[model samples]
Target: MRHSASFLPSRKTRIIIGTLVGLFFAIPFVATTEYTFRDVDGHSTIHWANVFDPAKQAAYRPIWTGLGNSLLLMVVTVAIVLFVLAPTMILVNLRFSKLRRIFEFFALLPISIPAVVLVVGLAPIYLVVGRSMGTGAWTLAFAYGILVMPYAFRPIQAAIDSINMSTLSEAARSLGASWPKTVLRVLAPNLRQGLLYASLISVAVVLGEFTIASLLNRQNLQTALLVVSRQDPYVSVIFSLLALLLCFLLLVVIGRAGNVGSHKKGRRK
Candidate 1:
């Protein structure tokens, strides 16, 4: 039998409540900030538009580079999280227990240390590895992977917990699927939402990261945000609005994906 209707609210009521809650915080954030925008005639301007001009872009080249780094960080972080951390975490938490407990402690240890302490300690280590590796991006990715690890592991474990692994694995084995094939084909499909959430966390962390990038003398989004703010406050506001918009878009995309996935599962059931 379905649950009682008394516990449930209509969709419109929920939307209105959510909208009000969001605007309550968002409005104040914008209001407290004194950043202004203008047109060529000193007229008022739009929010979240491409306010950058081509001729004046020379002043904003650093910003473009920062955006590139941020985007790259998102890509690299997602790749590492999916390929490296996801497998490592799943195998440990699922296949091994005592050993996984020890490793998982180490995995989450970074969260205990202060962000500043980690940044200072990691910079020199990355520099040394960066020199030996010949590709700074890889070393940086490894370091960023450390930051991403904590974000990726918990959700993956949660997703793993929610699934019936023994059934899936047994079914695959009966069908003569190889171990790797079973994991790749059967398990990963089940973990898609966890993967998406992990990727989102990794991307957001990598994009907004400043401490490691600045300490290592590598420019990233947060660093770029700082530089843009110094030269022109309004331009910095423009960049902030752009980042906010991108973040909003990403959440929307994720929600739509989740809805589609839910519908697909309903059809199968």
Candidate 2:
């Protein structure tokens, strides 16, 4: 009891820390919310209501377009994480165990590089991509794949580390399962939590990204907000709040799903 108590903070300390942390985040959100409700006359919900007004659709078209592009990018980025990164990681851990360190070094290299530096390196490559791919906004997913790799890698790697991949793969193979079948049927299910968390993180990163999209002259949610803010700042703030809320909801929902799965498994055992 004494040892456990040593690790736990006193109730007063917990309350003080929680309040400070809450204010740190809540203050800015509250300020932005207040700003969005303010108008030339007084505080009102006109800006909020105008967001859904059909007659004003033309004014918000850029935001809609950017949001659409961002959603597409999010899909493509998650696919890269699922189909490419996760599989490669599994292969490294199971087959090329010795290369795991080297692979991890490269997987995490992007986090050390600044976004501006990455854009500088990617600019020349995107020129070729634009030539071949016709400059579609979805192509930004390639860059985002790299940007989100470090974030995605951590959770997936932790999942990989938790399991006996070689033992599981060998058992599946011995049972007449092909390599592909073993990975898809036996391995992937176990890694679902990591994959889902990685996908969610990738979505958040792609949505919040602005520098690369702006530098590459691509239209995404953040860039569209910048463009719209020039005309109406309220709309931008409203959308920004919505994006934050969406991310928060995704995190909570995914976390709850993981917990539910755990509880079910526990009860079955």
Candidate 3:
């Protein structure tokens, strides 16, 4: 009698499936020849007879600049988050248990808070901060910090959770490694994905954040897209493509985090 193969699919099969799906999606863009048109408000104000009209192609360049701004905003916001929150997260993992739980709960607390409330609550705060800090994207970055929490907290928390931190701390103590050295040296290396992961999520979140940036009167990528859509629906479609690309990158990152080196095993009591 012939034996059945393992029920689980192999990695190559999974990759093939993913590639097919990607190609299926890519076909529509390749097959279609029309360039869609929209008014400044993002609505397809005029369905240009030719979708890829020469004029439409020329106008496409500004959207590229807008996309650049979007990427910049994402990068800056993630930087700020990593700079400010990483040490705080490290401290929580080290010194405090009950407080750590509370801190984490509050970090997640921002998630449950309605988007409207977040925008509403932050609008005034940003207005004041903006006045003191001056105008433009960095102000947007600060607002983004709050908006990023729902997405940003998860990876950092996962990083903290992964380390046999308790064991690491004990080992550090036995070796006479100072607390800072243990945290900075022994613990930080294992957190590579977590470090990069949280920042990457922040990029996607800040890039897409409309409510807070809108309230703050900032010119973030989403707001630019929204404003442009009124006059051109096709432009909106292109923005959709850009947004989708960012989202796909975010997913790839979360997927990558799953493939990191094996967890270090520690000794028992």
Candidate 4:
């Protein structure tokens, strides 16, 4: 009688699968990168000189401004998530556990709202902000914070769930530590991975965010990239490759943070 194989992929099969998945992503990246290096005649040549041409700097000024704006949005969005969502999530989980589902539902509401719809709804808010705040790209942070809540909330929740928040709080309180002390000292340190993960996701989201900013008559990285594509296709292709590389680096950062967190947990145990 023939024996059934193990109900899992073999080591060789896993390697094959991993290779194919990497190739699936790598193919497009390779094509774009190759195209970026090609001249108008389609001959392969390093385009670094053209990319940094002093005469062409003026042409790419909008893109540089957009990059600065995007980075600002990322920082503000991460801060909002940390200061607002972190405390609120901890409070609900510790004091109003029953409201957890409601909190999650609200966090997820943005995902259901399309970009165009969100932009339409936020128009009045933008008008008020523009009038009060002088219509800078920094104002985009508030909307971006809302958009990234769904992604940011999950890692934070998962991190809290991994540790016994109630026990830690009680222990801290028993030691005469206040609630803020417990959250900032006893709990926050342990949630480093979660915070890093949330920040990484938020950065990625802001980098690619275009619709709301565009409709609001603001510029961002993605919108700037679109303009680049229309004006200088090869340069835009190079930028796309660089964006992908940045994303990969962020993922690597998250992975390292996770490993570090795990190591600390293990040492504590």
Write one digit per residue (lDDT tens) for candidate 4, span 98-147: 99999999998999999899899899998998898988888899999999
lDDT of each: 0.76, 0.92, 0.71, 0.87
Between 1 and 2, whose lDDT is larger? 2
- lDDT score of residue 3 within candidate 3: 42
Model 1 TM-score relative to the real fold: 0.78
lDDT of 3 by residue, 108-149 (tens): 887788777877777778778868987656666766777787
Q: Which pairs clash in the backbone of model 2?
A: none
- Candidate 2 TM-score versus the reference: 0.90
Collision pairs in model 1: none
Q: Write the residue-wise lDDT of candidate 1 on 59-167 in tens digits.
A: 7788888888778777887899899888876677557766877877877887887667887787777667777886444356767888877777876776777688778
| Number of the predicted model whose TM-score against the real structure is largest | 2
User: Estimated TM-score per prediction?
Assistant: 0.78, 0.90, 0.70, 0.87
Ranking by lDDT: 2, 4, 1, 3
Error of 2 at 59 (Å): 1.7
lDDT of 2 by residue, 222-250 (tens): 99999999988889999999999998888
Model 3 weakest 10-residue run by lDDT: 260-269
Each candidate: RMSD: 4.6, 2.5, 7.1, 3.1
Clashing pairs in 4: none
Candidate 2: list runs displaced more than 4 Å.
Answer: 2-8, 254-269
